[model samples]
Target: MSTLVKEDLFENLLESAPANFTEARQTAKDLYLKLGLPAPKEEEYKFTGITKKLEKSLSNFNQAKPLSVEENLIKESVFQGFEGDVLVFSNGKFLQEVSSTIEGLEVSDILSSSAEIGSIAKAEKDAFAALNQASFSGGISIKVPKKTKVEKPILLLSFNGANDGQVITPRFWIEVGDFSEVTFLDQSISMGEEAYFVNKVVEIKGGLNSHINYYRLQNESNQAIEVSNIETDIQSDARFTSVNISLSGDMVRNNLSLNLLGSNSEGNMYGIYLLNGKTHVDNHTNVDHTIPHAESNEMYKGIFDAQSRGVFNGKIFVRQDAQKTNAFQQNNNVLLSDDAIVNTKPQLEIWADDVKCSHGCTVGQLDEEALFYLQARGIGKVQAKGLLLYAFAGEVMEKIEEESFKNHVVGLIQDRLGSKF
Candidate 1:
């Protein structure tokens, strides 16, 4: 392991962090020192090659300090055709001048209102998560009061400034009160042509009878590398749903886990990734049913082209007391080119006798029979192929509840296909 702790990263930034998070940061710092960084020898990171990727991405990292950005670039980062309050963050500074406030939503950067800041995310176990906790000087916090339903989605836009070889860390904590409903859209953008690394962590808490929907769209630059972790806790009578859409990156790793702590809670996970060139992406997810009558559903699909690689590892766990639990998980992948590769693993562990659990994964090529049928119907070859691939991915897209965001995602996919299908 190399020396990853920079003097500026520790001494300068921690000075500005809120006082309430001191102990958590200290504990994370200690854990980071103890764990160093994960290598291929470690089981969790065997196929990702994250250690080498980080070493290369951070060879001359500068943290992108003293942020400076162009006006037009900020405009480009904003979500187009979306009606919502946009909260922007550049480097570590919250860009309040251009951000908007919602009526029934409480937003803060101080993080004082949250009691689960570090408790839900286990910083002691994962090195990257610990690094994020120790080095992130600022983050965003959102709260929905009891019985208050937010009509519009809240967008969190994060920008990594134009610093060569910099590291950007974005963190978030969200809480929803009982009987309330809300939606959150999270995105990250890179401004410069230089190489950079992004480390992010999100923790969400759902009160009893709460309904929450969270969406993450990732389309980072070709020179960017990232590690993201999302941890959600769902209470009794609450429902939590999360979606991840990844398009571009040099190397990316996403970790998502849901903990159903109360009976009658439900959790859903959906994801799609499109890869080309030499890019690499890995998605790891887990759902834990701790009480009786809990349910979870998960599905992830991928399209790999060129020499790119993809990996998916999903696990569903049912504890001894989690009787009457129902869990399902599946992963499907299509290789657009022979050189592309994929690794998928779907796991299920049950300790209860009266539980229904199922898991499966598939890796294959496009259906030639379907393509031939489409071509026979007067569709061009390119259009036929695009239609087949789009149809394969449309299942996950249908899970999105927001109409405008769904249309935006559809437009992105259509542009990528470059066909009149």
Candidate 2:
């Protein structure tokens, strides 16, 4: 693999694009220069050796004809009863033929919506997010009308390339107007025929008093590699909640960042990950309280088995003037095998004296006492383990208020456990 840097890709992308988008691309390119890839000495990325693991040759790629992915694959990957618009991306290309458009929603391509949204993706503190903006070729742009509330959930489906060493990059931008409410479910799945790499970037803008519920499902084959970034700006009194589920991947890394730019805004982040058979998953998140009277809560849980590895790193920053802020973060993990590994860190950087902020993390195995007690009650060992494991993961699962979606995730977890136990 050639030792290609982000600057090479950034320059090539800018040279190929039109002059109209130069300003936005230049901003991202400059940010990439300011903040290079994280080194091993960096505190936040100490445990995650992403730069070392993902050192592969960059392929000059672009949008292509959407793959002939099966409709059954789409039906099996999303939340049940979700009857809203569907945007499908196969092999990093927009599949408009298979996508659905909602009645009141404006779904357009990223380039098409630039005039109205004024360049949806920005380059600020995140290097990978900036890299995504610089190299992203195609994505979906969704806009909801002001004061409108959608009854159904919009689903975005993405599938990886079906050939070996094929890398697919898909990006998304979702915006909800003032006083609007909507639910978005984005799922990434890989076809089982070959090994592939999937890179995705998703940006969300929540208007004043708007409510947005987002769920991300990352379940691909063991040979797949995934890197996804999601950044959101919350307006005054806006409510945003995201639940991220990571089940299978060869190497999966997620970057979730939220900017509380307006007061009285609320943000909730919840994640659950299950891995086995040498799978590796990482979740890195940042929640910034830039304005006063903002509240944020984050929790992530994981279970690893049979030499699998999981990593969780979360940071909550309370700015100096952001008083009256309430932030809480916790990460917990369970190791089901002697070889299974989990590394978790919850960090809090507070400059405001009046803020209430706390962070904690724990890593351990299944409760031996609970297992023995269940066994004494004539319960099979495998069944008892599944029950205990379910209860361990149930903490974050309870945050899903929608019963149907919650139950569906629970069922998926059970199915995963049934295979091993």
lDDT by residue (235-343, candidate 2, tens digit) is 9999999999888877888889888989999999999998899888889999989999999999999999998988898999999999999999999888888999888
What TM-score would every model get versus the actual structure?
Answer: 0.93, 0.89
Candidate 2, run of 10 with poorest lDDT: 56-65
Count clashing residue pairs per candidate. 0, 0
- State how far residue 15 of model 1 sits from its true place (Å): 9.5
Write the residue-wise lDDT of candidate 1 on 1-421 in tens digits.
4355433333443344446677888888778777767756777877898877766666554455535645576677665678877787776455666677777778877344555667788997588898888777556788899998888887787777546436667678888999999998888777766777788888898999999999988887888888988999999999999989999988999999999999899999999998899889999998999999999999999999999999999989899999999999999999999999999989888899999999999999999999999999999988888888888889999989987788888788867765444
After superposition of all CA atoms, the RMSD between model 1 and the true structure is 2.5
- Compared with the true structure, the alpha-carbon lDDT of candidate 2 equals 0.77
Candidate 2 is scored at a TM of 0.89
Clashes in model 1: which pairs? none
Clashing pairs in 2: none
